[model samples]
Target: MDFSLFAEEYFDEVLRLLRHLCTIPAPSGEEDERVRFCQEYLAELGIEATLDPAKNLLWTLGAPSQRVTLFMAHTDTVFPRATPLKLADDGTFLRCPGVGDDTANLAVMLACVRCIVEKKLPLHRTLLFAADSCEEGLGNLKGCRQIFADWGDRIDRSISLDCSYRGVYCRSVGSHRYQITAETEGGHSYFAFGNKSAILPLAEITCQIYEIEPPVVGNSKTTYNVGILSGGTSVNTIPQSATMLAEYRSDHRECLAEMETRFAQIFSRAKEACPRLTVERVGDRPCMGEVDPRALDELSHRAAGLIQKYTGICPEFRSGSTDCNIPHSLGIPAIAFGLYDGGGFHTTEEWLRKDSLKPGFCIGLEMILREGEAE
Candidate 1:
């Protein structure tokens, strides 16, 4: 298929839309502004978009049918509400908080809708374009959960355009995140000498947990990390409390369960070693697994081929999580593709490659065309 034609025709509009999207500050749960922008933009393209109670923006095209295909991108960015989303001096890159992490993806979804409407592509299955909210941290995957609860059975497939800069993600690398807190009675460091310190026990527990071997096999990678840690009140005093946040990722559910079991053992050992210590698991995010690798391979290969045709770079497997996890866990066919090259995703130095926007638009257009032909 000749995707360049659409790119050539809509290049200016695509750039404009991307720039506009980068200006909106839609941090995770607070996606009201971004949602409004998408609803209005979709409306301009003659597509009816709706916002759910969770502030997820959904734009529907074609009639609802059994073989419905949902195209999803998150409207929420990783930046906080106060961060300024300003384009930089360099013309090639746009720098801002959350520019590439998701705003670029949102822009690509919008451009796809415009292409579909302008080109009048005949889609056999209903196309549902969604700008999901609350994909980061404590927001959880509420937006996607809502979609699954409402339309999962009728939907045949899902294409999630999330924060990828490399290749396509066909296999679901499931992850479980937990917040652990250890506490003890406060005391003076010198007076409480030889007494168990909460910080020391927490550190020892973390080391023991990391020492446990992961059970994942084959090409799939299984890993664990302690991302955050905090404890201790003063340099001269015995710390009364300590807390650590950790996450484990693997392609196999059993492997994750095994790791969880091992973690419990380690915690119990830590508690036994330090009678004052207490451990608690405060958060959990399920791991995603592919239902059919062959089917996913077929879709990914075709999508990668189209992306390479336009951008001269084939898509790569991304290890990060997204709303695709929801469908992938449920055995639904799904893939998370990137719309642009984004860097420093959750930090102040975040930037979006402007040059990639047009190519991304073409890639998404081609994906939609291909979806219409799926048997």
Candidate 2:
């Protein structure tokens, strides 16, 4: 098949969609403007689109059927509400804080739908295209969670376009995020010289957790990190309170469980060392496991072959989590793929390689077509 033909015919429309999505600032929990834009765009394309109560935009092609294939991408970006979005001077890149992270994925999803419609292809199963919300930080995977809660049983296969680059992520790297806090009675350093300090306990606990070797089972390697810490007031006064935000990630669920057990043990030890100290667990995000290995391998092989045939780079397994985690946890066949070459995400320096869009779009379309035919 001549993939370039598909690219040539859809280049203009894809660029137009990318420009429209780049201009909208749809940060997490605030995707109203972007949702409206997508609804109108889908309407123009003659696809039936609706915005659910959770503010997710769902577009369907063809009639509702028992066999359904879902194409998902979050409309929310990591950028702030007032970030000014503009095309760069070079006319090749979109210059904005969150343009590459998710906006690019949203645009690519729209482009794929446009291609399917413009080509007049007959789809056996219903195509569910969603521009979901609440994907970053505490927004949690609420948007996708709702979709699965509402319509999970009907979906035979699903894919999320939130990779921010051209890659196929079939393996799920589950993660557990925790906010740990310790508090103690406050007093001046000189006056409280013999008293237990919250900072001391927190530091000791952190050291113990890090010093322990992370578990390794099969292909999965467990990892832990204390990403954020805060507590002390001044040099002369002992800190009364301290907090550390930590996370554990592994491809295997057993690894996560083992780490969790170790963490609890360390916390308990800290409490024994400092009688005045108190500990609290604040928040967590569950890890995503791999889909059926055979199914995942087949899809990966097909996707990698197509990508190599077009872009000369075979796609590889990714360890990051996305909306796919929600469905993958539900035992649904899901993967996250992207259409741009995004680097330095969540920063002003983030950029997308414009040339990647064309080939990426073709690959996405090919994957959808193959998936629709798969039994």
In lDDT terms, which candidate is top?
1
Q: Give one digit per residue, the lDDT tens place, for model 1 in 75-153.
A: 7776777887787739877887777777777777787778878878877667777888887766677788888888889
Error of 2 at 161 (Å): 1.6
33-65 in candidate 2: lDDT tens per residue? 989998998889887788888889887775558
RMSD of every candidate to native, in Å, equals 2.4, 2.5
TM-score of 2: 0.90
lDDT of predicted model 1? 0.77
Clashing pairs in 2: 174-287, 174-288, 175-287
Measured on C-alpha atoms, candidate 2 has an lDDT of 0.76
